[model samples]
Target: MNLPEFATTRTLNNCPAPAKLNLFLHVTGRRPDGYHLLQTVFQLVDFSDLLHFEVRADGQVRRTTEIPGVPQESDLIVRAARLLQNAIHDRTGAAAPGADIAIEKNLPMGGGLGGGSSDAATTLMALNHLWQGGLSREELMVLGLQLGADVPFFLFGRNAFAEGIGESLQKLDTPGLWFVIIQPGVTIPTALIFSSSELTRSTKPVKMTDFSIASKKLFGKNDLEPVAARQFPEVADAIKWLGKHGDARMTGSGACVFCGFTQEEQADEVLKLVPNRWKAWKAKAMQEHPLAGLLDR
Candidate 1:
């Protein structure tokens, strides 16, 4: 006989860590500590990488993926689990339950999608309930901040109006619009975009009131788009191709370009016309993250 493990004590193991699109990004200032001050509204997409975790009785946190260019010791998920474990031990005086994390790579590296941040959030959320640590969202988010700037947003698991170096988050009333997301098989180093001499360090911040009532209309331009186009011609090409059917913009300092479509068929039609070499995915808008849906009783 075979059976499904419906009575398992685990919470979120296989979770979706979606990519985010910054409707607009502005570098307001630079801190004395060297972290830049930023203001942006991060729109989370349904597209995501899958992270799976299995509880370990042996009490060890580990990663099963070899993320190219990312050191194992510095892996955000591992660091996040360890941090939570330490926090739990310090607070409750119990050895934290452990897990082996498996990351299914979907989002491209250096694509400005916050893939690492999302993974860290999932790890924290899953472990909190799995170990019966009884942590609130506030507590989890605090732990998340030490992992990365963007990790806290995913802890909330919704599209948000973010500011102050992407830590401050306010959930938005965003709509469900399909997207034709394309990656031109190129990796654009985020450091290059931020550090480029031509990068816009000074840009006026736009009021949230300026945004459209629906997600279909373009609220404003992506400040990183022009610089990214100049750095990677492939991104420019993808944008141009996607632009023919709908409004196209680069997500983050991306190698990935996205165009919004009111209808799935419209995006599908555009997909047929796109070159085969580019990595493309058509995803519908999710008001709540997949993990969020799973969490709700």
Candidate 2:
């Protein structure tokens, strides 16, 4: 029999990569590099994708399993391992470290919840330890950034208030509220939304101190929502339905919509009211990533 997760999830060979919700996403501006500058808050959720790593002695990074549509070379997990391997080789001239990575995915792709970025982050953290790379969080984060903008924040390992293309992070004291995240069973194309002429590129920047302790709960809004909603009716439907229970917003450039509740029972009640056609899950916010201390914070 397979041992339950909380009981055995942190074993030597298996590691957890938690999912995240963008409590709010603001497109502050666009960089000359063609990347969009963003101001957002990243909240860790209990929902996660678990990775099981088997180290390869001969220095070959590989994935033992397949993610239905993603090819092996293109998987973020694979890319992360290779990126670290190359960086470690350059840094210390040590034996190139490698692993056969396997995934237990729970987070949905294109749901705007940072599944791919978290997977890549976990690969860097896990392989860094298993292969004895000995790189600090500082080193790992640089390699993480090459994988994706969001990768570095997962390596930051906290609920953060982010800015500057999502890398500049300041830890936030946000509440760990219960979340009712409803997946509208649609895959949102982030690129499509970003390129649309309808997207508002300017949302006045807010100081972190602008919100009082009591007002923090009311401050989240996704600037991408209206654009996404216009393209995907399912997204609009989810936002409208979830908003009935609590203030709801799209997480990231989302196809998934979520609302917060102070009580688990309150979230559970709203979760029950979700239309049967949609997929949904109840999760609690995580103050820190599960693999947080694998490397120094």
Candidate that scores best on TM-score: 2
* Per-model TM values vs. the true structure: 0.91, 0.94
After superposing candidate 2 on the true structure, give the runs of residues whose Cα lies further than 4 Å from its correct spot: 1-11, 212-216
| lDDT comparing candidate 1 with the true structure | 0.78
Model 2: colliding residue pairs: none
Tens digit per residue, CA lDDT, model 1, 31-116: 77767777777878877888777788888887877788888779888999999899899989989888888888888887778888
Q: Which ranges of candidate 1 are over 4 A from the true structure? A: 1-7, 10-12, 213-215, 293-297
> How many clashes does the backbone of model 2 have?
0
lDDT of 2 by residue, 49-82 (tens): 8888876678887888788999999999999989
lDDT of each: 0.78, 0.85
